[model samples]
Every structure is written in C-alpha cells, then in structure tokens.
Target chain A: MENKILNKLKNSLDYLSGESISSDLNISRSAIWKHIKSLKNKGYIIEGKSNKGYKLISCPDILSAQELIPLLKTNNLIKDIKHFYELSSTNHSAKELARGEINNGTLIIAEKQLCGKGRFDREWISPSSGIWFSLILKPNLPPMEASKVTQIAAAAIYKSLLEFDIKVNIKWPNDIYLNGKKICGILTEMKCDMDRIHYLILGVGINVNLEIDDIPDEIKDIATSLKIELNKSFKRSDILVKFLNHFEILYNKFVLQKDISEVLSICRENSNIINKKAKLITYNKEEIVTCLSLTDTGELLVKDSDGKEKLITSGEISFRI
Target chain B: MENKILNKLKNSLDYLSGESISSDLNISRSAIWKHIKSLKNKGYIIEGKSNKGYKLISCPDILSAQELIPLLKTNNLIKDIKHFYELSSTNHSAKELARGEINNGTLIIAEKQLCGKGRFDREWISPSSGIWFSLILKPNLPPMEASKVTQIAAAAIYKSLLEFDIKVNIKWPNDIYLNGKKICGILTEMKCDMDRIHYLILGVGINVNLEIDDIPDEIKDIATSLKIELNKSFKRSDILVKFLNHFEILYNKFVLQKDISEVLSICRENSNIINKKAKLITYNKEEIVTCLSLTDTGELLVKDSDGKEKLITSGEISFRI
Candidate 1:
C-alpha cells in the first residue's frame, strides 16, 4: 500500500491528495497517513500542504526491493529481488537460501558486504559505493557445462556497460576490465552431483561508484571503479537492471535452446586477452602464452612459447599489459 | 570413560570385582556402578553378583559412536564417527556439517534413515536393518574429477565384500550387485567453485541384514540383502568396519597420490556389466551396447550398435538379462 502511494506520487508531477490516495488504493484516509509516515521514516522525502496534498521529493539511493522491482524488465527469470542494507556476503546468503527449494533467478543484493569474496576465496573489497550481488540460478545443465554460466555473465556485463558509452573489456574466464584495470569479477559456484547440478550461485561484484579513498592502497593501482574513470556517479539500479535484462536473455538462450552463439560473440567482441600475450597461472606452473580465441564451449584457446596450442579450461590469466 | 569400562568388560570372561575395577580405572566404586548402569541402559546386558563386579552378557546391534569408533582402524581418514539411531538422511546431516570448517574425515552414520534418498532424488527405503552413512571428504581436487570418488568407493565395497567370501559385482557408477540383485548404492555429492571443490559427501546405503519382509514390495524383485542372499544375519559393525578400512586406504591413494589405478583395477575385476550387453540410459535416449573395459580415468568404455566406441561418463546402465 505504501509502495502504491509512493509510486503514484512519483509518477505525478502535481500533488496527490490523501482522499484521492485512499480512494485509489481502497484504504482509509488515516491508513494512507500511517503508510506515508512509514515511507518518510524509510528516507523517502515528501512534501505536503493543506490543499496541495503530497508530492514525492526524492527517494534515497538504496537497493530496496520496492525501488528495484519497478525497474526490472524480467519475468520469471527474476521472480523477486531481495535487497539488504548490509550482509556478510551475498553469495553466502544466497547459498543458504539455495539449499531450500527456492525459485530460480532469485536475486540477493546488498548495499555493503563485510566479508565479500571472489573466485578461490580471494578478498573482494565490497565497499558501500559498489554493487555486490548474487543471483541464484537452477539451470537444467550438467556439472561439466557449469562453466558456461561465467561466460554468459561476462557477456551480460560487457553488453550492459556498452549502453553507458563506457568501453569495457572482459578478461578471459570471468573478470571485467576497463582500460586495463579490473572493474568487475564474477564468481560462479555450485552444488552438484555426478550428473546434475543442484544449484549455482552467480556472485558478481562490480566496482561502480567508489571514490579513490574507498579503495585500499594495496589494490588501488589494479582496481578501478566507474566513478574513477568517468568522473560521474551512476544509479546502481540502472546498471543492475541492464545487466539483469541481458543476463536473462543470454541465460534463456543457453539453457532453453542450448545456444551460446550470441554470448560467445559478445565475449569475443570485448575480450582483452585474445590474440595477446598473457601469463597462464596454474597451481603447479606459470607460463607465457598468446591467447587465441574462445572455443565453442567457452574455453580459452592459447598457444604456448613453443607454439603448441592448448585449450585452457580452469586457471587464471594475467594480461601482460 | 563408559567405553573404557565396556571394553574391559567385553574383553574379560569372568566377572570383575568392584574393588579391582575401581583400582584399575582409578574411579570411585559408585562412579563405576553409575557408568555400568548407563551402559546397561544402552542395551548392553550385564550380569552382576554380590561379590563380582560386572560381566557383559551381550550387546545390542547398534552403530553407536562408542561401538563403531573402537572397531575402526583408521588414522586421519576417519577423524570421528557420529552414529545416530535415526536421521532424516546421513548425507543431509553431513552436508550441513561440511559447510563449516569441519574436519575432512568427519563421518555421519545412522542405523535408520526416515527420509533416505538415492541419485536424482530417488527414494531409498532405509529400514533399521540397513547401514546408512555419509563420509565427509575434503579432497584437493577439481569439480570435474569428483566422479572418481564414486569409483573409489565402489572398489572399496567390492574388495571388502570379497574378503567375506561374498562374490559381489559392481554395476557401473556406484551400485553393488550380488547374484544379479542390487545390494548397495553410493551417492557422491559435492559443493565446488569452477576450479576447486570445497567438500564432498560420500553417502553409502547398504542392504546388510534386512529380511524379506523389510524390503519394499515395489522393489523386492530387484533388491536383495545379505540375509536373503546368504540365508544368515551378518553383523553390521563388521561390514561397516571393513568398508571404512578399505575406503580409507583407497581414498588416501586417490587423494594424496592422484592415482586411481588401484581402484580402477578392483572395479574392473568385479564389474558384471563389462563384456555384457546392457542398456545405456541417458536423459534423452537409451540404447543397447556392449560394455567394454574401464578406462584409465574410471569412465565406462562401451561400443554401440554401430560399432562406435564411446566413453560413458554420467548415466545409468541397465543390464540386459
């Protein structure tokens, strides 16, 4: 009821009277006042006059469900969005929820993460200004095909950022790079049996609007945020909605039709490592290799110093740049 | 302390005097009596007299930690064994524990599973006569190599049963068959990232001493127990202990040495499907094929009707009797 009134007030240029809101929502006048009071306490600025009624001034920059749900263009892919003010890690919370028979495409977003993590349990500094979220996906795919999800996410992030006129390049496997600095990281983890996957948590951390001081000194040289590059702030919802839209389309194509041609094309278009010399870091050894192209299955095709071509499936690729 | 008294009483043929028992254990006479009384309540029959202390008459067939821990001969593979009379499912309990920073070899065993499950959420009717348990393993392997654990477990069961003079044959992909009837099933599930496995639960359900009446009517024709096959009741602890010992040895080889050659040998020795015509059951299609030898990596090598040899990684095999 509060969201309805807030929406009405937001859509209208003029004021919305209490009597009109009560009739529009089938609630009492006093109920409207009560809900308005609650919305005010939630950092929604509103102005009211005796005859002019109520006008929505502005909404706080928070990833609340009420604020994001109205902006999403997805259907069943994202049945609902859950936004938290703070969390230990979005992936941790999503994994706990994924244990239950939750719906697919359940989104878990947080304003800040106390102990955010990336691939291989690396520390991901999720400050208050960045976008930290995890999408719980239950794709009808086998365990071996799970790595394709990272490419889909990478393509989604690359295509979405293109709409903002920001040239972003995807570092092979699952990282987003802008001008040779890391901008986003996607960590895909799953619980699976021998043949089937139970559930997968697509944890994505993007450095959106972080200031220079917000980044730790140790990683400041390697990490770059959107605000640091563009000298302006972006609405996190706009970026998130765009990513979600692109993800839903690519995910449906891959899962339903078993087609990844579109996602692969986008990945090829924006990859920074392809046709370039990079260091392939594995557990036991590291070697210089020239990354070729992505295989049909999304593996990195690389040629070593000896000119032996190999398909790199699982490892880290450090760009020589 | 109670296990100490029970062990001493179990080893002794004659009744021990209370004064001598107190002196040996360094506990008060009343404390000894209290421990003995508690042991008796746990279904251990004791014969007591005026002068003689306590004589262990008989023990109930239960998989309690006190009973199974002393029977296992493992160093670090089985750090602890927690046995319950009943559980929803041992794998369910073990997965919960695996989420925490638990030990690698933590074992969860149950005499009865009220809601037992098999692969793909199939119902596994676990009566009190069965040995249902899950072993928590933290192998330093990738997600793709997880299916090898099932082969190791299958090899362990096959080798262990051979020691009992039982000619058991392994069906491909973790099922134990004796005389063309199913006797055991192993379900291995894991939580992992793209490159590393966090933990794995090796859930094993064996039809040990279940009578004909205990078998579900729907599966009675296909399922058989040790008692039904051999016409005698075998001790569950003896079978469980043997399995644990074999599993510990095989698991150590696979995890530490990255060698599954020994396990593959055992699997190839007892496989009933090899050199026989069986139906390869996949999700979309099923076809009759002659099962060939096991591959080095433990996958099934089968020849289809077209004489094309293919490597079968994940699917079910129904023997064409």
Candidate 2:
C-alpha cells in the first residue's frame, strides 16, 4: 500500500498530501509516514508535514543503488551497482564480487575504504573525500593484454577532465596528472588461465574534493585535487558520471574495435613524459634516457645518450624538468 | 630454558641417552618428555623413547620461522617466512604482509587456501597437493616492468624441473606444461605509483603429488601433476626446497642484471609455442598465424598467412597441429 502511494507520487507532479495518500491508498497516516521515512533512507528527498502531505524535493547524488539505477541509461555497461559505506578496499570487494556469477559492468563503489590501496601496496586514503570505485569488465583478451584496459582508463579520465576544460596529462602506466601532480590513479586486476582472461576489475580513485591538508604532507607535493587546481569545489557526483560515460565509450572501443592504436594515440598526445628528458630506473640499473615515443604495442621508447633506442614495457619514469 | 635445550640439541650429534640428558640438562625425565613433545608439535622430528632419551631424526620440511631460519642463506632474500595453515590466498596474504615495513624476499606460504585464486578471480584449487606460495619482491623498477619477474619465475621453474630430469614445456605467458597439460601457474601482483613499483608479490602454484583423479574432470583434460607424469609419488617437501633455491638465483639475476634477456632466452628455449603454427584470439578478432620468434623483450613474433609480421604483447594462444 505504501509502495502504491509512492508509485502514484512518483508518477504525478502534484503535491502528495499525506492524509490524502493515506485515504486514497487505504493506509494509515503512520504507514504513510513510515514509507516516506524509508524512501528518505534510500536518498529520496521528501518534504512537508503529515497533514500537508509529502513533497518530492530532490534525490541524493551519491553513487548508491538507489541513485545509480535511474541514471543507468547505457545498455549492459552497468548491470549492477554494489554500494558500501565502508570497506577494506573497493578493488578487493570487486574481486570478490567478480568471483561470483556477477555480470560484466558490475560497479562496486565505496564511500570510504579502511585499507584502500594504490599500486605496490601503497595505502590509498579514501576517506569519503574521493571517488573509490571498481568496474568489472570481461574484455575479450588474454590476461597479459589486460594492461590495455589501464591505458583506456587513463585516456577516459583525461577526456573527462578535458570536458571540464581542465588540462590533465596521463603518466604512463595509469595515472592522470594536472600540473605534474597526480589527480587520479587506475589499477587493473585480472583473472585468467594460460590462454584467456576471465574477468578484470578496473579500480579507479579520483581526488575530487580532498583538500591539500587531507593528503599526507609526504605526498602533498605530488598529489593534487580538482578543487585545489580549479580553486572551486565541484560535485563528485558530476565527475563520477562524466568519468563513467567517458569510460564506457573508450571501453566499448577497446572491446569491440580490437584496435587500441586510437586510444594509445590519444594517451600519447596527453602523456607528460613523451618527448621529454627522463630517467628510466629498473631493478639493477638506472639509465638517463630521453623519452622518444610510445610504441603501437604500448611500450615506451627511449634513447640513451649514445642515441641508441630501446623499447621498455616496464620501469620507473622520472621527468628531468 | 627451552631455547638453551634446543640449542644444545642442535649441537648434539648423537641422541643423548635418557639418563645422560636428565643429568646434563638438569631436568627430570618427565620434563624432558614434555620438552620433546613441544618440539614435535613445532614440526621437529624426534626419534627414540624415554629410556633412550631423545634423538633428533629429521625436521619436518615445513615453512616456519624456526625451520626457514636455518634454510635461508641468501643475502637480502628470504628475510622472513610466514606460514599459514589456511588462508584466503597466499598472494592476498603476501600483499597485506608487505604493506608495512618489509624487506625484499619475504615469503608467505599456505598449506590450504579457502579462497585461493588465480588471475581474473578464477578459483585456484590449493589443497595440500600443491606448493602455494608468494614472495614479496622490492625490485627497483617501474611497476609496468614487473612482468619480467614473471619471466624469471618461469625460467626458474623450468630449470628446477630439468634438474629432476622432468621434461616440462612453458606455455606463454606463464605456465608450465608437461605432456601438453599444465602443471604450474604464476601470478605476479604489483603495487605501484605512476612512476615506480612499490612492491610486488610473485605467487606460484605447482601441482606436485596430485593424482589424475585428484583433478576435476573438466580440468583434468588440461591439467597434469608430477606424480601422474612420473608414475610415482614424489615428496612435496623436496620440490618446494628446490623451487625456492632455484627461484632465488633467478630473482637475484633479475634484480642485479636488470635486463631479463638471459632469463627470457632460457624461457624461450623451453617455450613450446615458438616456431609453431598458432591461432591468436583477442576480444575483437581471431587470426591464424605462424610463430616466427620471440622478441628480446618477450613479445611474441607472429606472421599471418598474408605474410605480414606483427609483434604481439597480449593475446590468447593455441597451437595448430
């Protein structure tokens, strides 16, 4: 009965008088009050008194099941939304969720992560001031090839920031930077046998509203946020929606087109290290080399002082200003 | 007092006669019995009875702080050993253990994994029949370059099996196959920043003593074990020791040599996919191609029927007869 009243209210534009809803739906006034409370708990903004009835104001913009469901306009890209108020890590949760029979495009979002993580077991501070989410993708590729997803995510985040007219550069591997400070990071976790990848979780964290003080002093020099760079506060909801839409496009191209050259080209165009003097540090040796270009297969091209060119797929990059 | 007694036992070449130990150790017979029982509980094998005192026969080949301390002889490698009776996953445990202050070569081993997993969230059956372990590596390289460690591990495993006269073939990207069936798999998980790798966990699983029936039918067609292939049960403890020792050598080379061309050369020599007619399957397309050779950087060289050669870093592979 309460659901019926809510349905009527959702379909109608007029003010839903509580007493009228109670009488029309054949429910008690207290019952109407209880339904309104439940809808409010689910992020519905219902206003007005018991006698004056309830008025639907506005909904919360958080990425909860309640909010995300109505906004899921794409076909099969986002099949489900699993929201957590707090978790150890969104990537860990998404990995667990993917282990079950969850469909592709499953989105796992957490408001806060107790043990949020970055690449190499670094602690990621996700204290409700940033966007912590993981998307489940079943890309048609082998496990070794899953790194392309990280490149696609880097491209997507770059494109999203471009929409806001923000100049964001991609740091090779998978990081979005503005003015040499990291604004976003992407980690792609995959499962595969010898031949094929079964599923992948693209874990992304964007520092949307984090203040400079919120980030630790040690990394404050290297990490910046949208609010810090823009000198204005923007809604994380809008940023997340923009990122998701942009990600869907690049991801669709990646899975459907099988050609990552275009995506790679875009990433190279926005890459901060391309054509720059840099230091390449590996396990045993550190070479002072100049960044030449990125290969079509996603490898970094570097030239030594002797002008010898080398293709590097993995190593640390240090820009030599 | 127990430490003193253990130390004495370590020095003693002969099992002390019961009366002699009772007098020399200044402990009663019953006390000696109790201490011997405790040592046994800690996986020390003791021989002889109360009247004969106790003789140390052989220690259990288990991964423990005490057991591994004597076995660990490498510098800056095998700094610590964490053994678990059961865990969610060794890779997960190692990643967590590596989060705080940890030295390179910290090893995490589990006898059983309740939620053991492989790449892409696939369930990795890690019963007592396999060696399930993860090694924490702090290579001074960029995170994207961590794939070289996988190549090192593949080379190590291949070399170790050759020591036993076991004919094993490598299936790209990182699997060991015997008789055209997989016997081992490697998963390399790295934490990284945009520029450098923070740390990495190289998880390795090898089926040692499992019989044919021990494997599920669906996977039985694609999986094999040492015992099944050798027609005899082998000691898991021996294989584990050999693997660790072999891995240390390759790992040292990986860190000290920086370039993995030496390791990759060995890997290519053992890989069965080279010079074979193959089918490359990506998400968007499948093509019949001939394996030409392997790049020094580990990319596969494939020549399509149209006589066009391409270097592929990621895709599924199937050998065409």
Clashes of each: 0, 14
Locate the minimum summed-lDDT window of 10 residues in model 1 chain A: A312-321
The DockQ value obtained for model 2 is 0.15
Q: Give one digit per residue, the lDDT tens place, for model 1 in A136-216.
A: 988877787888999999999988898999889888888999877899999999999886889999999999999988888
- Candidate 1 structure quality by residue, lDDT tens digits, B8-89: 9988999988888889989999999899899888889998897767888999888888888888897788887888889999
Q: Please, what is the TM-score per model?
A: 0.93, 0.72
lDDT of 2 by residue, B57-93 (tens): 7776555555555554456667778888788999888
By DockQ thresholds, what CAPRI class is model 2?
Answer: incorrect
